[model samples]
Target: MTATAIVLLVATALSSLVPVIVRRRLRSTLVVDAVTTAVMVGFAATAAALAADAAPARGVGVVVVACAAMIAAVGGGGYVVRLVLWAGGADTRERARDSATGDGEHVPDAESESGTEAEAGPLRGGRVIGYLERAAVAATLLAGWPEGLAVILAVKSLARYPELRAPHAGEQFIMGTFASVLWATAMAGVGFLITH
Candidate 1:
């Protein structure tokens, strides 16, 4: 790998990791969101600066950069989705937990604060779903099988169909899923860039 590729790879890795560290270190969603935005911008600037270097990474450098891109796809989507949700005024907070069940499931509804597994709460478990969705999307793209995106979308839409009827659920689902898939595909593109 050229020095530019190394720098770009490092930038990609930072993009993948900095938000997670900032989110854990800071309590302010605003600040963490700001950092996420900044990291993305920084990554773009770094990539642009080195974009002229069309030399693909070789051997271990390819593996390392690809891994960084995968991490960005899987882990970075949370920040992207969170930022979108926050900007759109969606309630990004997890629903109130049920004390009775000892599980972390959301409080079901007005009728039941105790939260049975059957009830669909707003944006419940969305974080994990987003992560998994992005992971799958990233993996498929990185594997050179773009058709996996259709399967991923179909599965998610079908699975989320029941909960889509709830208030704000459809909006959140669409926004989050769009942000997530975009982020994953973009990161996968970044990974591809490392090869060319």
Candidate 2:
């Protein structure tokens, strides 16, 4: 790798670390804190890839088109997987333990406290939206948007604070690992396309 590539790689790695460090230091959720880091890593990876590739400008154009197509396919695939998972009755958030208290119980409905019947959740709609969200997220990596993608993931991680806060250490580690790998792939993918 060239000096610039090395620098970009280092920068991407460091960016990925920022959210985890911030969350840990703040005693807060890893999800939110790490979003920005992931996005930056993606961007850095793209830049590094572009720098490393000796392709001519015309070749760059072709790469761009190819990368876009690949990203779309990956994003679509992720959505399809999510949809299938949803159709199979896979979501179990209702059974998930409350992260805050480790209480294996659902929070009482707000309407019940108001002496009214509880409302139904939009579970199906939520599942569809979740798939769309993942598609968008995964697509960002495949597109020439690794940095932006990382940021998006970091934001998601932050938003998912409720899901992760007070998680078992093993759970948190697993999540971190997954996030790292995903972001790294995005960076590497975009970079490879840009450079080649």
Top model by lDDT, which number? 1
- What are the per-model C-alpha RMSD values against the true structure? 6.6, 15.0
Candidates in order, TM-scores: namely 0.78, 0.30
Report how far residue 146 has shifted in candidate 2, in Å: 21
Off by over 4 Å in 1: 19-21, 94-121
Give one digit per residue, the lDDT tens place, for model 1 in 89-191.
7765422333434564443343233433333347567767888998899889888999999999999999889888889898889999999999888877777
lDDT of 2 at 78: 28
Which residue runs of candidate 2 sit more than 4 Å off their true CA positions? 18-20, 30-34, 45-49, 52-184, 190-196
Error of 1 at 122 (Å): 0.9
Query: Model 1 TM-score?
Result: 0.78
